[model samples]
Target: MKKQQQLYKGSLNTIIMKLLENHGRMYGYEITQKVKEITEGEMNLTEGALYPALHKMESEGFLDVEMERVEGRVRKYYKLTESGVKETNNKLEELESFVRNMQQIMNLKLS
Candidate 1:
């Protein structure tokens, strides 16, 4: 809905993985609400994109899943695999570097 949301698309996985890295496991709905709360609704992850990404990461062995029934509904929880933990660290470093580089470029243009 906002222009900044478009810029966030590329970092969705890093966001999700980092959250899981810190918070243990989480379900899809929980992940959505958490992101909204953290960013004050500036960033959102649609179910359409989220599930596919979760499945892809699972298939790639970056995430492991467990299903449980909560209030008569099944919920799938995702957590990082051993490889995923390592990847999260690498992703965080890359993301931080990108932010620093972007900040430098923006500061140059502003001056």
Candidate 2:
């Protein structure tokens, strides 16, 4: 029930990539729920946003999707491709650097 906002656009991909890195493979709903839980409800991703990113990543060869029949529904599970694993690491590093720069600019310390 959280509203979608512009700031969440690019970062969702990184979050998904990181989740896949840790969780191995997961379905769409599971990904959404996990993100919500991990962020303590601060980040809420809509299917509209999530599916496109998943599909885009798959099309780009960053993710591999496998369909499995579960209880009458086809659940599309996603995992990182080799490229995705590399990309995840790079993105995380980039995010870390960005955070450090922001901290410097703001003259803030994490203590």
Candidate 3:
């Protein structure tokens, strides 16, 4: 699985939050498409993982859900709550720090 590669598995929440942070709100499918678009299909987020994380965030009060009718079907959109906004910022910082550390650690030349 793409999630098992490198350190991406841990950053799913960060990735979702950041996308919601930028896009304001999105449904599960939209989030998956966006990730694929951004990563050029390198990363694939499975439905099992995405929905559970979304539900967990919803339960944690980090996300607020809005239901809308589109194409004769109800679509559930997830928006970041006030607490989610704060959490997103924190997660972003944490991810950035980790990336920088990894970069530095991997910068060594093989002699």
User: Candidate 2: which stretches are off by over 4 Å?
Assistant: 1-4, 108-111
What lDDT, from 0 to 1, does candidate 3 have? 0.92
Candidate 1 lDDT over 1-111, as tens digits, reads 677877888888899899999899999999999999999987888999788888888898999999999999998999999999998899999999999999898889543
Top candidate by TM-score: 1
Question: What order do you get sorting by TM-score, best first?
Answer: 1, 3, 2
TM-score, candidate number 1: 0.93
Better of 2 and 3 by TM-score: 3
Candidate 1 lDDT for residue 15:
92
Query: Once superposed on the true structure, which residue ranges of model 1 sit more than 4 Å away at CA?
Result: 109-111
Q: What pairs collide in candidate 2? A: none
Across 1-111, the per-residue lDDT of candidate 3 in tens digits comes to 543544676888999999999999999999999999999888888898899999999999999999999999999999999999999999999888988998998997889
What TM-scores do the predictions have? 0.93, 0.89, 0.92
Report how far off residue 60 is in candidate 3 (Å): 0.8
